[model samples]
Target: MDIGFASSYLRSLFLTSLFSFVAPLLLMGSTIAGLSIISYVPWLGRLSQPGFELVWAFLRTFGNGNALEGSLVIGSTCGLVGALFDTYIFYRQNTFRR
Candidate 1:
């Protein structure tokens, strides 16, 4: 491949890889933050305890049975893992490229 072509291709790949790794965590963190804020409401609080509610329990277990910081920690860890997964997928895609 030509030098310029290779450089551009690498730049694109780098950006894609970076975005894939960061976007999910940012989205997840924002969602978790928004939900945490919304859960302060009385009625919606009740609706949040079936599926994603375990986050609270997990957070509580981490701290003094409280679900704020713990949730963030858990969510961040999950996000990091997710980012790693994205990186792995990028690697695989590049490896299998035609």
Candidate 2:
């Protein structure tokens, strides 16, 4: 009865939070790995590493937006989690009965 859909969607939200702590790492890794070979690259460098300076222009280029990056991920995932958790609570309750 679409209960499975609710369960799966909730599962996805759970996974989001469970893995969201790595958002900053993902950004730095993407820069290193040429900005993810799968996703869209910026207009500057299409298939190469972006040379944007993050914090210390003289030394570091990444890890500048670590907290900001994590915050963005947590905010987005929290919103999703709240919505899906509310919607799926009924299914979860019913599933427990069966």
Candidate 3:
């Protein structure tokens, strides 16, 4: 493998993993914030109960430490799958170039 290509690929894989790790936290935060704001509306407050319960359940699961392990397993699997897909695309492009 070319050193430059390898380095670039590794960098991309790292970034993909980093994003995969962070994206959920960001999404959860935003979702909670949105729900909090929505709950302030009287009519919508009723609807927010289920959403809050769902988020609470998620947090409760995480609080027990299961979520961390699950997230790691799932995230790594997804990252590896993404890396393999990227690698295949890169290989196909290089092969075509040659």
Candidate 4:
């Protein structure tokens, strides 16, 4: 693949990994924040349960809160590694240019 294509692929992988990590943090934060907001609107709060459940499951295994947290940690680590790899690739490509 050309550099552009390769870079795009890499970027997508990076974003996927970033999302894997960030999404959970975002979801967890949202969930906690939602909890506070829900208290104010009892009926709406109940309605939010399904959304929270869906996010939790997507972020974790079987909607387990702890698992979601773990995924966030692991995904962040993987994202870092992927970034470093991308940087190294760029460096090598630039170094080869006249």
Candidate 5:
């Protein structure tokens, strides 16, 4: 109930939400960017590399094998999973401290 406790709690919550949103979007964007860039810049493929290949393979197997579909699938799945994981970690930290 004290200011110190409230501030700390809010900080943790903010971090959890921020991380859940940012990390997945970054991953999804990067994956799509990697896929997009391969045609234009072949030599710089090192940046995305095998990770892009793996994701592309997944898209080919499960989805329509297009960039838009891949982006949607990757974004949604990564966001959901990342949110769950971040929430779990946040909950565990709060509970274990008590």
Candidate 6:
């Protein structure tokens, strides 16, 4: 086994994990901010109330329980899967070339 190859792969895997984890949190934060802004829009607020309630409930359940841990686990799993897929594709391409 090549140490350099292994290290490079691990580095990519870590970056993938970090990106997946951060992207969702950023999206969630932006969503919350947008919703908060919308909540003050009078007519729009009334229209969005039920949807907001549902979202709030969902967040309360997941966000309060184990959101951070869950996100980490999910992100790592995704990264691993992506890395595996990439490795498979690379091998396939090399095999074809050889």
Clashes of each: 0, 0, 0, 0, 0, 0
- lDDT value, residue 40 of candidate 5: 65
- Candidate 3, residues 20-76, lDDT tens digits: the string is 766666666687888989999999999997997687667656456454454455556
TM-scores vs. true structure, each candidate: 0.50, 0.26, 0.64, 0.44, 0.48, 0.62
Ranking by TM-score: 3, 6, 1, 5, 4, 2
Per-residue lDDT tens digits of candidate 1, residues 1-98?
68985687667656665565566446646767777777788998776555356654655786577666555555556556655665677578768996
| Number of the candidate with higher lDDT, 1 or 6 | 6
Best by TM-score: 3
By lDDT, the candidates rank as 3, 5, 4, 6, 1, 2
Question: Model 6, residue 13: displacement in angstroms?
Answer: 0.3
What does the lDDT come to for candidate 6? Answer: 0.66
Against the hidden true structure, what lDDT does model 4 obtain?
A: 0.66
Per-residue lDDT tens digits for candidate 2, residues 1-98, read: 58987688678666665555455445545554453442354564543433433312322322244644544555565556655665587568778999
Clashing pairs in 2: none
lDDT, residue 32, candidate 5? 72
**Between candidates 2 and 3, which one is better according to TM-score?**
3
Highest lDDT: give the candidate number. 3
TM-score, candidate 1, is 0.50
C-alpha RMSD values across all candidates: 5.7, 9.1, 3.3, 8.1, 5.2, 3.5
lDDT of 5 at 35: 71
Q: Between candidates 1 and 6, name the one with more favorable TM-score.
A: 6
- Candidate 6 per-residue lDDT, tens place, 1-98, comes to 49986797768666765676567666656766677789899888986677666655665565456555544555466556766776776578668988
Error of 6 at 27 (Å): 2.1
